[model samples]
Target: MKDLDTLKYFLGIEVARSASGLFLCQRKYTLDIISEAGLLGAKPVNVPIEQNHKLGLASSPIFSNPLAYQRLVGRLIYLAVTRPDLAYSVHVLSQFMQEPHDEHLEAALRVVRYLKGTPGQGILLRADSDLTLQGWCDSDWAACPTTRRSLMGWLVFLGHSPISWKTKKQTTISRSSAEAEYRSMVAVTCELKWLKGLLLSLGVRHHKTIKLFCDSQSALHIAKNPVFHERTKHIEVDCHFVRDAIKDGLIFPSYIPTKSQLADIFTKALGQRQFEFLLRKLGISDPHAPT
Candidate 1:
């Protein structure tokens, strides 16, 4: 690899540098997806998924063209490379790919419409910000109707730039919100440990506690508490790995308010105001000049 003057491309995301900072976007790819979906003339929307909209298998006739549904989903999945904010929405929509119907099509189109309005939106890595590793994990209990499985989500940041994130439905059904949250915390803890190890291998040590923030006080209490009772015995052995690591001084789980939970963007849908607030918090910015 030769030393380049400006970041033209990296990991499939087109990077454009400016005097202020680096702006990353996938505008060309986004436009191609819009055209392929034949939604170029569709009105743009401010938000991706509609607030309070519950999606499920359509009760009406399913889409005859499975390829069309697959194609749109594939585009959206690729769009997620530069758009971590759309992870949850895309993950939810991708579930219906096997048997997509008109409802699913409309939901997917809503996301495309949203992309149309904010095509230039992407992660902004500021040059002056401190590169610290901080993370937040959150979960939504029994969010899936079919399996009643919880969704686990977390966001890891190197300073202001979000480097890692995930939105996955839990494999095991959680009996309570606290249990669901604890499971998510464990997942985040494992990621943090791996990140720390990876950085150390590259001679980049954080030298501080990798803060794993969670919104559930019950989960936090469970982690700090040693005595497990009958109610908590059902939790999987792997989920307790976080608690063990905490004892070994590997990670420190911290408490954070729900409003400030950055990982909330990944677990479920949000209103325009709340969603935009978290988007800004995640270091996503409009490539265009700010109004």
Candidate 2:
């Protein structure tokens, strides 16, 4: 067995440590993707995707090369490992990989261009984090124009640093925004439970109830209230664990205003100002950005 020196790089991710925190990035990998996408000389955009974009309805000509679009989006999936801010953008782009069109390709390139300006942006695990577990969950009702399905996004934090995040579509159509938001709460609750188990296995016992925040007051009421109303009768029985978790003291439900919802970045394409504002709340930064 060979003895390796201090950790530096692994699996295309670059790692660095300092007095402040441990930083992880894919600067080389990001640059390679941008250059291959032919956006190395392109101007950077403030946001990854356009606001209120009808990407699902884009009717532009089919891309001349579908393979290129698939390959580019595939690379982005890898890059997103350390770039939580890219989660929503990559999710939206990957959907069109099967039959990518001109507009789809252009949107994928916009993501690359956004990365061009800050290739070194990545996760920072602070040295002095408190290690408290918490999470934010959100949903965009009927976000899919094709299927009329909802989209959900969540971000779980181990202390101030994000450890896990995801943006996904609901399998079933949600009849109301509250239903969509409640479904998202259920999804994030499951994630927080698994994370707690992982921490326990690491000898970090978290006795306190994990906090899970949502912007929907209706969903919070549904989870906290034991008696189900006829309005919520349609929710799947198996998904009711969210209420059970609250009863077990495993989760503490809280309310947050929509404008301040950190999970908004994962659910919808936002204007530049709102997107940048939410990114800051997620503890994401570009330490490598020019001063």
Candidate 3:
């Protein structure tokens, strides 16, 4: 019927092409957010959230206006689609939208200030011959101060390009770091299965088993070894599901060093050095950065 032109911009996301591949960013939308919040000229920060600073309800003064807080956080959440660096911070701040405190509002503003520094920062989906499905999953165990629940983060890469990702809180309280990591592995496994099926439907042939990486060796052993049955009793169902995937040759779980963990950026706040390093590793860069 109608053949639309190639996508340039859709729903606030700007798309650009280069000899390398595609770059997606929300520069205009990010700038509008800063201007709306009256922080256009505000000082920029290196990272969105301060390390070791845990925010919770009743931690600071009640915000004068709750509506503004909700609106700001909602917009930031939408912006995270193209800016994975903002996912952890936006996910943290969105929790207090109902009755945000002054500290929460300040934290949200700090994220906007960070965005001011590199509004053009976005994901780079490079063109590659490799079509292998891979993923990195990580968890911050009991990072929440109030509930003591853990946070899960994952990134699914088709060859070198990150296509799907998530930063979310786990539904259940994990007893130990290993358990938390194992649960994250389960989540990523499910994502891999769906992604593989989608590729098949699109007529993309991938015969190799998807490889999943995690920094936790204990989690890897838990998925492969039946000896940890006692310790994994609580999560027995999850264990079987993951083990079955490995057995059926659908996924292959492996270990990665902590420093090389790509999903760490999604689970917690980081210092400037490590944060920028991981950002580069994740293929997030601003072509407009000072030369």
RMSD of 3: 1.3
- In model 1, where do residues sit more than 4 Å from their true spots? 1-6, 18-21
Model 3 lDDT tens row, 1-291:
776788889899999988888999999999999999999999999999989876864577789899999999999999999988988998899888888898898899999999999999888888763778998999999988889899999999887878898999999999999999999999999999998889989999778988898999989989999664568888989999999999999999999998889999999989999999988888889998897
Clashing pairs in 2: none
lDDT winner among the candidates?
3
> Candidate 1 lDDT, tens digit per residue, 86-137?
9999999999888888888889989999987887788877776565678799
Q: Put down candidate 2 lDDT per residue, 28-147, tens digits, no spaces.
A: 999999989888899998889998888999999999999988999999999999998899999999999888989999899999989988889988888888778998999999999999
CA lDDT, candidate 1, residue 57: 32
lDDT of 2 at 119: 89
Residue-pair clashes per candidate: 0, 0, 0
Candidate 2's displacement at residue 217, Å, is 0.7
TM-score order of candidates, top first: 2, 3, 1
TM-score of each: 0.93, 0.97, 0.97
